[model samples]
Target: MKREIFVVADNIFTPLGKTTAENFENLKQGKSAIKQHHNAALSRQPFYAALFDKKEFPKEDRYTKFEQIVIASITDALQQSGLNTSDEKTVFILSSTKGNIGLLETETHTPELFDRISLSASAKLIAEYFGFKNQPIVVSNACISGVVAIITGMRLLRTGQYENAVIAGADVISEFILSGFESFQALSPGVCKPFDKDRDGLNLGEGAGTIILSSNPKYAGNIKALGGGISNDANHISGPSRTGKELSLAIDQAMKDADLSIGDISFISAHGTATSYNDEMEANAIALSGLESVPLNSLKANYGHTLGAAGLIESIVSVQSLKDHVVLPTMGFEERGVTRSVNVAKSIAASSKPNFLKTASGFGGCNAAIVFGK
Candidate 1:
C-alpha cells in the first residue's frame, strides 16, 4: 500500500531569510539575492555571486560552512513541523550536487580525502544531529537532487517502509562549483535575468531547505504530493533538448498521476536559470502544455541558481506562495527573449488559487515536475 505524503513544515536558509515565509516574501517582492560576493573565501573565481553572510550562520555546524546553514534550516523546519523525532521510524534523505565538496576541493591532491566530502558522509552528520537511527540516504543528482529526494521520500512513505521522512537539500558556494560553472560559461557576471532578451547566465546562491513529511492522519501539513512526474531529456548531459520533449513528458506524467488535466493546472514555478537553453526550453514546455495563460516565474533572478538545494528550496517557496496567499514577481526581466505562447508574470499579487507546478531540469539528462495545491 503506497501511503500518501503531506508536507507539514518546510523551511529555507536563503539570501532572503532564515525562515521560509521571509524567503517567499522576498521572492514575491521580486527581491534578488544575487549580490556580488566580496568575501576572501573565494579567490579563484572572477565573477560575482549571491552569497550568504557567514556571520548570519554561526549556529550552523562548523564541519563545513554549508553544514551550518543546513542544520539551522532543519532546526527551523522541524520546529514548525511539530514532528516527534523520538519515533525512530523517520527517515532522512539529502539531495545535493556536491554534498560536501568544500572539503574535497581542499583535498584534490589527496584523492582518498574524498571521503571527507562524500554525500553519505554529510548525511550521516545530519542524521546524528536529529538523533535519527535509520541510515540516511543521499541523492546526488546534480541539479535534480532536491526534487529527486522529495520523490524518493514520497515513495518511501507510499511503500510503508517509513511512516515519516525528513527531506533536506543543500549546496554551498565553493571554488569547486564556481570553477565548474565558469568552465561551462554558465555563470552570469551580474544578477541573472531569466527570460530576458539580454539575459546572460545564472548567478549562484547557497542555502538549504528541509520539508517534513508524514503519513500520519494527525499530521498538520497542508500540501499533499497529489501527484508528480519525472523524466530525462537525454538530449544532452548539460544542456536541455531543443524540442523540450522530455520536460513536456514529465509534466504530463505528473498531471496524469494526479488524475488532472491540463486545464486543472493554475501556474508554474519555472526553472528560469536565465541561461539561453534553460529558459527557452522551459518556456517551450509551458507552451506545449497548452496553458499559455498560466503565469510563470523563476528564482534564478531572486536567489541565483542554488543548484541541488534549488529543488527543495524552490518547492518549499512555492508552498509558501500558496499558504501566504501571495505571488512574487520575477526580478530582472525586461524583455521577452523567446517567442513562446506563455505569459510571464510581470508583477506580484496578494493571492492566487491555481495549482503550482515546480519544474526542475539538471545536468545529468534528468528532470522532475511536482504539483501542489491548497
Candidate 2:
C-alpha cells in the first residue's frame, strides 16, 4: 500500500488570513481572501494585483521583501509543525516563480543591496533557519512548482528515506512581474472573475503556504493529500487547449493514485486563472475527467494568482476545507463563460465527507493536480 500523506500542522495563511485559525474561520464563514486593489501605489498599469500588507512584518530596510515573506511563511510553518532540532527526519523543499525579484532588481539597478537576496539565498536562508543539514531542492516550474514540490516530497517519503518534510513556497510582488505580465497583456485591470462571461484577465498575487508532511502517526491532522497527478498539454506554453487532453489525463492519474474513481471525488479546486483560455481549458478538462459537475472553487478568487506558490496555497486551503467539512466560495465568479462544462461556483456542502481534487496548469506546458482528503 502507498504510505499515507497527511498535513500534520500548518500555520494560519497570511495575506490570505490573519492566522491559520482566523483563515480557516473565514473559509468556514465563506469569506474570501481576494479583494480589489485600491492602492494607488501600483504604477499606472492596467492590471490590478493582490499585495500582502508588509507593514505587519518587522520593519526592515535591509532585507528584500521576498526574503521577509519567505522567513514569515517558513517560520510559521515550522512552528506549527512542532519540529525540534532533533527532528532530523524532516526534509526541505522550496518552490517559487520569482525568487528574490527584488534582489534581481537590486543587482540590476542598485548593486549595493544585491548581496542579501538571490535565488540560492532564498533557499539557503530557509534551510539555515530550519538548521537542516541536507541541501534543499529548489524548483521553479512557473505556476505548478508548489504541487511539484509536494509530489517530490511524497516520492522521497515513499522511498523510505525520510519520515517528514516541509514544503514551503513563497513569492511577492515585483516590478518585473507586473511589467512582464503587462507585456504579455495577461494582466487584469481589476479583481479577477474566473469563468465569468466578462472575464478579462488575471490579477497577480503575492503570498505563500507551507505544509509539513509525514507518514508517522504522530502528526495527526485534519487534512491529508491522498494523491494527485501531473500532465503537460504541449499544445501551447501559455494558452490551453480546447480539448483539455493533458489536464484530463492528470486528473485521471491522480484519482488512480488515491485509489479513488471519479465518483469518489466530492469536489474540485480548479486552476481557474480567469484568463479566457485557462478557464475554458479547465472546464473542458473537468468534463473530460467524467467529473462534469463536481463542486469546485478557485483560490485565485481568494488569492489572485500567486504563480508558482499558487498550487501549495490552494492545496493547503483544500485540506483545511475538507477537514472542516466546508467548501470555500468562488469569490469572483459572476457568470458562466464559453466552455464545455465542469465550472463550479458555489458555497458547497459535503454530502459524503469531501475530498478535493486540486488541479493546475502552468507555463512550459506543465500541469499538476492532487487529491486531498479531510
Candidate 3:
C-alpha cells in the first residue's frame, strides 16, 4: 500500500496576519495588504506591494530578514503539530528563490557574508537551531520552489527516509528583487488584477508559510497531499510555454498520480500572476486540461506575488478553504482577459467540494501541479 501523507499543521505569516486562522478571516472579509510604497531603499520609483513594517522585523545581527521569517513560520507550525524536531525521522526543507540575496547589496562583502548567501547555509542554521537530526534540504527552483519542496518532502516520507517533514518557504522584498522585476517590466503600477482584461503586470510581496506533513494517520487532518507533478517547457529562460501544453502535461500527471479525474477536482488554485503572458498561459493550460468551467482564484492580488513563498502560501490558503467549506473570490478580477475561457472566481461562494487542484507556473518555463483532498 502507498504511504499516505497528511498535512498535520500549517502556518501563514504575512502582512495580512500571522496565523492561518487570522489570514483566512481577513480573506473572508475581502481585506488586502497590497498598497503603494515609497521606500527609496527598495526602488526609486513608487511601487505597490504587500510588505511588512520595518519596525516589526528589525534588522537582526544574528539572522537576516529571510531567515527570521522562515524560523517564525516554522516555529508556529511545529508548535501546532507538537512534533519533536530532534527525532531522527524528522527533516527540514527550505524553499526560496533568493536566500539572503539582499546581503549582496552591502558595501563590503566579506567571506562570512558570502557564506550567508548560500541557501543551504541558511537552511543548516535553521535546522541546527531546532536540533534537527538530519541535514536540511534546500529548494530554490525559481518561483515553484515551495511546491517542489512539498513534493520532495512527500516523496521522502513515502521512501521511509523521514516520518515527519517540516516544509517552509519564504522570500522578502528587497532592492535586488524590485530591480529584476522592473527590468522585465513585470511590476504592476497599482494593485494587480489576475485574469482580468485590464491587468497589466504583477505586484511583489514578502511573506513566509510552513506546512508539516507526516506519514502517520494519527496526524491526519481533512486534507492530505494526494499527488504532485512538475515539468519544464524549456521554451525560454524567463518566459513560459506559449501553447500551455507543457503545463497541461504536468496537470495530467498529477491527476494520474492521485487517481483522479476532472470531475474529482472541485476547484483550482491558479498561479494567476496577473502578467500578460502568465495569466493567458494558465488559462490555455486549464482549457487543455478540459477544466475551463472549474472555479479558480488567484491570491496574488491579496498578498501580491510572493515569489518562492507563493506556492506554499497559496497552497496553505487552499487547504484552509477546504477546511472552511468555502471558495475564496479572486480579488481584483473583473472581466475575463485571457484568450481561452476559464472560470475566474468573482465572489465568495459556499462549497462542499472535497478536493482542489493547485497549479503554479514560473520563469524558466517551469510549472507544477498538486492535488489536495479529504
Candidate 4:
C-alpha cells in the first residue's frame, strides 16, 4: 500500500506579488506581470517578460540571485508548514535548468563562486543553509523540473523516506538563458496570449515557487497529491510532439494512477506557453483525453513562461482556485487558434468541483501530469 501524499503548504514569488494570495488576487483582476525589457547584455532587440523586483533582495555576495529566490520561497513555505528543516527525516529538493549560470560573465571568481555554478553545488549550499541533514537533491529537467520535483517528493514520502519534502524551483532570466531562447526566435515581443489566434511566441519570465509535501494529515490541510505521470515523445529537442498523442498518454496514465476518469477533473491548469506548436499540441492532447468540454486555463499571460517555476506556481494558483470555488481566467486569450477544440476559460468563473489537473511539457520531449484533490 502507498502512503497518501498531500501538499500542506505552498508559496510563490513573482513580479506581480511576493505572496501567493497577492498573486492570485492580481490574477482575479486579469492583470499581467509581463512587461518589456531592453537589457543590452541579453538582447539587442527589445523583449517582454515578467520579472520580480531585484532591489527587494538583500545585498549579499554569498548567494546568487537564483539561490536567493529559492531561499525566499522555501523559507515562507517552511514557516507556514511549521516543519523543522534541521530534522533528519526532512529532504530538500531543488528544481531548475540553470542555477548560477549568470556568474560565468564575471572575469574572476573564487573557487567557491565557480563551484556554485553547478546545479548540485548550489543545491548543497541551500541544503546546508537550511541545516538539512541529508544531501540535497537537484532536478534539472528543463521546463518540467518543478512538476517532476513534486512527483519525486510524492514518491519519496510514499516510501516513508522522509516526513517532509521541501521542493523549491526557480530560474532567473539572464543573458545565458535569454540568448538561447532568442536563438530559436521563441521570445515574444509582447505579453503572451495563449490559445489566441493572434498568439505569436513565448515570453521568458523568472520567479520562485515552493511546495511542502508530507504524509501527515495535519500538514495535508485540504488538498492531496493523488498521482503524477511523466513521459517523453523523443520527437524533438525544442519542439513538442506533432501528434499530441504522447502527452495524452501521460495524462491518461496520470488519471488512471489517481483512479480517476475524464469526468473527475474539474478544471485543467494547462502548460500553455502561448507558442503555436505548444498550444495546438496541448489542445489535441486534451481532446484526445476526451476532455474538450472541461474548462481549462493557461497562466502564461499572467507570469509569462516562468521556466522551472511554471509548474509549481501555476499549481499553487490552481489550489487557490479550488479552495475558493473560483476559477481564474486565462489572461490575454481572445480567440480559438488550435485545430482541435478546447474549452479555454475567457473570464473568471465559479466551480464547485474538488479536484484539478496540472500538466506541463518541456525541452527534450518531456511531459508530466499530476492530479490534486481536496
> What are the lDDT figures for the candidates, one per model?
0.80, 0.75, 0.92, 0.88
TM-score of 4: 0.97
Candidate number with greatest TM-score = 3
lDDT of 4: 0.88
* Per-residue lDDT of model 2, residues 249-320, tens digit only: 998888898888776776788888889888888888888888887778786766788877788888877777
Give the higher-lDDT candidate: 1 or 2: 1
RMSD to the hidden true structure, all candidates = 2.1, 2.5, 0.9, 1.5
Count backbone overlaps in model 3: 0
Per lDDT, the best of the predicted structures is: 3
RMSD of 1: 2.1
Would you estimate the TM-scores of all the predictions? 0.93, 0.91, 0.98, 0.97
Q: 74-123 in candidate 3: lDDT tens per residue?
A: 99999998999999999899999997999789747888878879998899
For candidate 2, the TM-score is 0.91
**Stretches of candidate 1 above 4 Å error?**
39-46, 57-62, 107-112, 350-354
Arrange candidates by lDDT, descending: 3, 4, 1, 2
Which 10-residue span in candidate 4 carries the lowest summed lDDT?
A: 51-60
Give lDDT: candidate 3, residue 224.
87
Residues 1-374, model 1: lDDT tens digits: 33567888889988788898788767766677777665555645456677887786565344677767778888998998777775777998888888677765555646566766677878888788888888998898878788888888887887888988899888888877787888898888888888999999988888899998887777635677766788988778778888877888888887776676776665678888999998888888878867678777787788888888998998888887777766667788878897696677778766556467888888877878888765
At residue 328, candidate 4 shows an lDDT of 81
Judged by lDDT relative to the true structure, which candidate is superior, 1 or 3?
3
lDDT of 2 at 73: 69
